[model samples]
Target chain A: MITLPDTASPLYEKVKDYILANIGTGRWGKDRKLPSENELVASLGVSRMTVHRALRELTSAGFLIRLQGVGTFIAPPRPQSTLIEINNIAAEIVERGNRHRSEVLVLETIMPTKELALSFEFPKRVSIYHSVVVNFENDLPVQLEERFVNPSLIPDYDKQDFSKTATYDYLMQKTPVTEVEHIISAIPADAETARHLGIDVGACCLFLHRRTWTGAVVATISKLTYAGSRYSLGSRYSPSKSS
Target chain B: MITLPDTASPLYEKVKDYILANIGTGRWGKDRKLPSENELVASLGVSRMTVHRALRELTSAGFLIRLQGVGTFIAPPRPQSTLIEINNIAAEIVERGNRHRSEVLVLETIMPTKELALSFEFPKRVSIYHSVVVNFENDLPVQLEERFVNPSLIPDYDKQDFSKTATYDYLMQKTPVTEVEHIISAIPADAETARHLGIDVGACCLFLHRRTWTGAVVATISKLTYAGSRYSLGSRYSPSKSS
Candidate 1:
């Protein structure tokens, strides 16, 4: 059994921390079998109920996996995103018990580029709203989001301060999207995108280009780039309609 | 009006090629308004029905977008994969009018690693089936696939010649997956993966880790890496359950 410490925090939290510390220091590596509840209770001088609560909490938190009759083991570190669902970054960070913050980089109106005009199906001369925001997970930049908004759909898009509230939240409130398209790719980051993402140029980035429509009118278009080393998108489904 | 040549193919095919050539050369760039059907018929010296058929075919093939009441315009090149669906690579290539081939790289029995043992919830001494294959689209290497199978689930996994058949197809025949999970990321290609993909080491690649389960047992786990420049995954959906 691993020797553990006692802290002022709750007994369950202390047990959880001891387990995390061992795992973090590689004393117990990934997939390493965890000491059973009886062993933990005996070694740490904790109640069996406390030990069970700690293990259950850890399992739900995704740090541990408990198998019936087999025992407990360290769960691999895998953060996942549903590929089909559009998620708000701030909420995701908070769900992981991490601090979330947004830094507003660029927020202005601009003329549409040829590609933008084509995606939005608007004339080239039409002006659009554009903004750049970098979302931080515990102070580490994880996502750099560049967005284009149809001015006719949301006329006041340029007036909001994104640092206070996320753009996705604001957009959802203004116009509920009826249809959306997501395009995912792995791409090498350009210099400007790298600067905003705090990643090196030419580094691999998971890229998602999204377009949303309200009824028949285009609402918003966005380019979301995430640091390759930090993020993953995932989904679990039954093979009923798809396989 | 753009000048174009007549080809030995059908008249509609000639018209389609004429439009494609102009778009390819950036002569009629993205979002560039196209001449009316009357103008196309007059310029290409083809019947109105022929021009209409050409435009309709291109629209259905995702090469052009014909907006009702607004005429047709050059559409951006975008290939997509539905994230929730497990697609057959051969069928996908054939759907795009391309040839599909597979090169078998490795097929053998291997002892499970500690991680694999934990994932499979088996002892370290247990043996598993493993294979590596590279899939090609029209002679262009696009995907490098590595798979591990639970031996108890598929006893003859090693005996099949993958070059003659796809593993997914074979697995579906033997065991239809009841549930599946997909985890996606962007990562720099390693030397071996780059070699198989015909790309430079450290180039960005799209990586997908997929695991399929039959009832309570894990059937297969795969690591699929694609050349970053060659592939994208996309889906268009109503914002019903997701936003």
Candidate 2:
């Protein structure tokens, strides 16, 4: 891609746009390496600083990754997932060969509030089991899961030791899940959650709110908050063969 | 909602969990103000520092948001949206009474690479119209959209000015979309993308990768990346109603 004309635009911007144009035009194919800084400066007729800034900027954006002493290369486009898959945090960490643990904070039955009654489609007077569990990966708190379960569905709920097993697994065995909803949000963690998650009091958390249905019974409603730095959500995309 | 004794644990953590329990169980309903710090200290029989820490942490975790002069209140639940409801960025910005513009970097019909061909479900030798557009919201770049369109479906695609009208709208009128697979990911913007989006070189980006099918012909493939600090992806969930 030709870059750095004697135009009014900044030299680096021109060079950066040129690189992007070539990449889009298949001039620099995916996973293919890019030219060195010196080569770029010479070819684009820009200063080393300009080329460096562009390359450095691109590397940070995930377009190109630069290894120390190694050449820079175009990153492979990520595959996006289609399924609305929401896995349990404890299960996910354990499956990744990491030690996972949880500290059970609260486990008791409470009367459903107006909102809960409406969301769960249950009578407002009914009692439900509420549990607050702070899950950790290798002793570092990653997710704070606060859940309310339909006590009627999970009989003898208070007898279960949740520190050893997730309510998700326990309820799955007790009743069949018919539906689920997953929600994600980013917001500042209050002082209490900051202490639990071991982050600054005002730092943000990525909150995942989930509600599961079991046949005619609403299984559980949970708000799982994760430290923004601790985890990332990923999905893959594949174009269909038929439109 | 009780704070049991566990002196060995961090005092703040113990207090915070107790408060979180009350909030989650609806003992502290949404928009309901919490007790003063002094009240909590007295009720929990904990040090002022411990109670303060707990409350401070809770406020940061999105469990509560503290207002100056006003007492702290429980946060409303996060909002959700329907699944993968694709909206045009330019149109959305315009609807908001903001000027929307785009710097068309590359717009050309080219033969897809082997992987690209497979992604678009076209013959290895087939050609596609590819475009790299930096869409601006009020002159501030917010989205970097890289897209591929099947030329066979829109043979005179070069005639359209995407800046004036989005490809999605144009395609929707020309072809009826039957199937779509959308993928979402949190990634760092590439150097080129960072420049276009006017964010830090390595800032996180929320990417929505989508593919649309229009009855046996793959319409297009798009990777829409948004600045994380400036944009968010949301969806709402409603319990399926049975007739």
Candidate 3:
């Protein structure tokens, strides 16, 4: 039953390493209950106190969750998007060692309607650019993005290949974004959004409405819809007086 | 029908004032469709361009939703929380000129379990303060707050009248919070959370898990659940390289 043969590191660290190795190898799946304290002690040939410390440290690090009277279970992985700044969906997925791709549903120029004119604060007689893209992580759709761009700001917005370059990156490179506003809401998936995200029609979704300005004129306004189970927003900061 | 006798403001401004007066008097309810531009021009004896400008400005200000080919409709109100800072539920409601009250659900000290020990990084042999309170905005339940406090940080943790003093306010005043981490998720409410929020089981909820630190020790961990239809989070900031 005794498995611990390495003595260089501390017992708790070795225990932690062993558990992590198993987790890294997918031997311990998400939400899987760990062995009991006594059972771990017997199998690892470590003291109960050592096993407890290892488990405690792992739990504290958010590697596991101990549910009081219940047993310890694996915590689900949270892919996070910070609210303080604009987050590019493709960068986020690729940064996590996953493949990122986009399905460009609609990409063309449209005559401004009363809605577009009001949103862009421009004349409805002019033309503006509109696009709808569904971003995927490892072939699973996570975000359905609908964006309206001011043609004057990015003249060739519709000409670029969105599948090769993300609209956020393309826009950023095209023009400097001076101001950004983000509004987060939990809403039921609309029909088009649900179809693009491949979720049920009434499924809950984390909806983000972002408006970016280049100096005086609003450059772009985006509506990003994330399926509830796919992604989350996280932030860590110090409390400030103005905040 | 031509009652545009006001000479002080511009024609569009007068038109805006007239429509706003109706809205303020509850004549134009939320999401109510408005008369067509031609109808407004005919009735007010104003030029079509003047009525269009007023409606455009109103839609731009988020007072109305212009559905392109369809007629204009009123926009819904959104009560928002910012993610950049720790938000106190009571303060937000009151700032919006609404009454806020808390229904104290559970307030007691409990012996630390394996879960608490790992979360708080304290020994399981000690006790910790735990409380659950449901906050209401003008008597409608909106937020459910469940918190666990480190006894050392606030010695009189269990003795406070939570309905009178919010846990966030009390904890911050007791010991200065140096750091805070917020993780946001769109989740279906569990039975207990649904009961407290007065929503259907499996209804969508905006869940915020916050952990605060005082000095080197974690002072408190809280789970704040907001009914999806009741509240949303919003923030505006300049784009940063890191974000």
Candidate 4:
């Protein structure tokens, strides 16, 4: 049973909003069975067509899962990466009710090459911290992160154990990022990235290159690769009124 | 030659920002040769290392394309699809300074199936306008747009010439959309889509499902597919203060 708002919206939209409110408030948990179309029609004093439309639209929006000949249930939550936010992989996995773990493959300080020096805007031949880590969700590798840290920003980078704390989490605590930029591309995985992610060579992957600035110096540059089949980046926001 | 800013930021960052500003303001056009490292160092009164770092970072960021023996030049712009904005494909190509064109494949009134009915939140068996248009960037197929429109909202949907005017552009002019939603996925292309987009079957494609609302009714539902090798969705915005 639900209450409908007396407003200018259409009858079906009111019905849809009522159902969405129930789901958002957690009254109807994930995978929980939803009321039958007839039950909703009868309880909400709406026609069968209106009730059916509401349920169908909800299902299409990823809020409900309909099983033919059985009943409709709430859809399970999927792991989502926010496109506009610099979020940590561990946090994203945990938010989806999954276990998150990591394996540190390479963590060492090295002399910056001309390219690396230019990327960080640091002098050439300077020492920089380089690391490669694979992040897993329920023991399945999801992301392979290759990161370079400016030694001037995080001098004690080698002292931390990355397996226990994600580089993003550690960096945020150590330095305040002033600006960030992301360049996204779909590229086939090379031999090294494929081996770490447990995917075949030349498989398509979502490659994300990120650079973060702290004050005036570039603090970190990272290449985050996700197996295209396993991960997707998403964002939802209202457009500005002017646009 | 670049002017140095009187700020607390590092010398190299100022140099990078100066170069970026010139590019952003269209003072230095695309593919235009940039000053050599020695010239920039002498003009900006900065060290050679500082000028080199600035040039290197700009190249990596896709602003400048560096040639080893030749001089550095402005990089050609890449086509970008905004993840948050409901943008038109024709406009995107034009924004990248490329010509845009389209070929209409399927355009007819279709009786809504059970799934399409649910998607549009309309009663089953109602007539809807369905269209398949392949968008091109200078004759290179980039996007295959398959769309379904609610006939009740746009009764004259079939009357427009879609090759001259995109469905998105037409819809925006016909009605004011109140809400928009996007769902992104990566999947292998089927035979039909492959043939249309000129890609091999089973090749990875970026699949985007979009729904737009006019008032309370879903005005349209669209599935826009892009060849993964040719197209990518991107966005860059400052995160809100609170995560």
Q: Which candidate achieves the best DockQ against the true structure? A: 1
**lDDT for each residue of candidate 1 in A22-96, tens digit (9 for 90 to 100):** 776877665598988898899888789889878876785567899989999988643221233345777778878
Worst 10 residues of 3 chain B by lDDT: B77-86
CAPRI quality band, candidate 2: incorrect
Order of candidates by TM-score, top first?
1, 3, 4, 2
Q: Model 1, stretches more than 4 Å misplaced?
A: A1-86, A239-243, B1-86, B123-125, B241-243
* Residue A198 miss distance in model 2 (angstroms): 13
Interface DockQ of each model: 0.27, 0.06, 0.23, 0.09
lDDT of 4 by residue, A1-243 (tens): 556888998898888888877765677665588888888878998899778877866775566899888998977642121233335778888989999999999999988788888989875568899999999999999999999999888989988899998888888778766567676666777899889999988777877778888777899999989888888765433331211
| Clash count list over all predictions | 1, 34, 0, 0
Q: Write the per-residue lDDT of candidate 2 for residues B1-243, one digit (tens) a residue.
A: 345676787777777777777875778775488888878878888778778667766664556778878787887642221132235676667877998888788889888889889888775577789988888877888888888988877777767888777765676556545566665555566798888888876566666677777666688898888877776554333333311
Window of ten residues with lowest summed lDDT in model 1 chain B: B77-86
**Which stretches of model 3 miss by more than 4 angstroms?**
A1-86, A123-125, A239-243, B1-86, B123-125, B239-243
- TM-scores for all candidates: the values are 0.63, 0.46, 0.62, 0.59
Error of 2 at B171 (Å): 2.4
Pairs of residues at least 3 apart in sequence or in different chains that clash in candidate 1: B81-B234
lDDT of 3 by residue, A1-243 (tens): 868746788888889878866765667664477877888888989899888878877775567789877887776542122223234678778878999999999999998678767878775467889999999999999999999999999999999999998988888778767667777778888898888899998788888888878887889988988898888876676543211
Winner on lDDT (3 vs 4): 3
lDDT of candidate 4 at residue A150, scale 0 to 100: 91
lDDT of 3 at B19: 82
